[model samples]
Target: MTPPLALDIDGTLTTPSGRIDPRVFELLPDWDAPVVFATGKAFPYPVALAHFLGRPEFVIAENGGVAYVDGETAVLGDPTAPRAVVEAFRERGGEVGWGDGDTVNRWRETEVALSLDADEALLREVAAAADGDVTVVDTGYAYHVKSPAASKGKALERVADALGIATEAFVAIGDSENDASTFAVAGESYAVANADATAREAADVVLDEAYMDGTETVLAALRERGE
Candidate 1:
């Protein structure tokens, strides 16, 4: 059997503005392999995408705080991060937009998606305010305030176990800092040409194209290898 494909949705499979390029759909290989989405997008987004794909295999959402598969959803990480953390950041004059009741953040169980500029110092202060129990992950699009245990790699392990597939029987692809964990754990990891330096360093293969074009490139390579 072909190994499952674990994909990061945002910069890995969509345009910079997060739209799926129609050309990407055209390039999708005709295969029965499981296509698991490992992303920081909220639960509903990935679930809807899976439904559109006609294959709702598995989804790792909110940077591994949640997992959905086979009509069942599970919280994979601790949901105890204090809500005051966001307030504290705001008090410190950090611009933060919470995704609590929004379309994407509503489905998040533990993590709080904060739409803000990437300020490492401010993020560190926010993490400290949470008593070090929460960590800030820069997902390229936003900073997620989540438990230290939340990670895409851990989610992949859980999904792989459920599918009865070895960890080595998977291909992981992404384009940002949060994706570094997925790249580290995948059997074969790939990054699009536009991926950040950290992701590029972690990947075994880096495609020349960007976004969905890069995704198509990797999928084609995987198909060739399987052939």
Candidate 2:
């Protein structure tokens, strides 16, 4: 049987040039096993991606602050924790930079995500000193301000339980520090060749090819073995 897949978007499934490869949208739905899109993106992004891809809406989003499985959504973490930190960041002259009517966060439920264009260094400094247990993660494409109560590792266990599969049955693929948590909990994990140091260290295998090329290689091998 094919092992279930937990995949990260952005740098993992995208081309080296950062566009979502059409091949990925094709391959994911064809996989015989379940596929969960895990990411620092908000819930709607993955839900929408799965719908458009005709894949299952098993998603771990907002860096695990929110998850959707079997059509029901479970929310974790303190929604206000990161909001407060962002406010502090702005107070300290850190502009969110997304400007008015920011659509990226309009649908988010449990945390604040800033564009990489935002001041990463200032945001981290502010989040670290903020009250509560929130933290910042750099996902290459963006920066997320999220609560410690939420993490992809912790959320993956929930996904496993609801699917009636062990976390060890899932193979995680990703390319950022945000994906490190899921890598820790998965039975096997692959870091794309362009993966950040944190994800590389956490993964069981580091691929030779970069981006979606790496993903296709891994998927091809798994399907060949029928596991």
Best by TM-score: 2
Q: Which pairs in model 2 have colliding backbones?
A: none
Taking all chains together, the TM-score of candidate 2 against the true structure is: 0.96
Model 2 misplaced regions, further than 4 Å: none
Question: Per-residue lDDT tens digits of candidate 1, residues 41-134?
Answer: 7888878777777676589998888887766677887866734676677787876664345565666677777775545588677779667788
lDDT scores of the candidates, listed in order: 0.79, 0.88
51, model 2: CA deviation in Å? Answer: 0.8
lDDT of 1: 0.79
**Model 2 scores what on Cα lDDT?**
0.88
Error of 1 at 112 (Å): 0.9
lDDT of 2 by residue, 111-225 (tens): 8889889988889888878765788888887788888889888888898889998999999999999888899989999999999999999999999999999999999999988
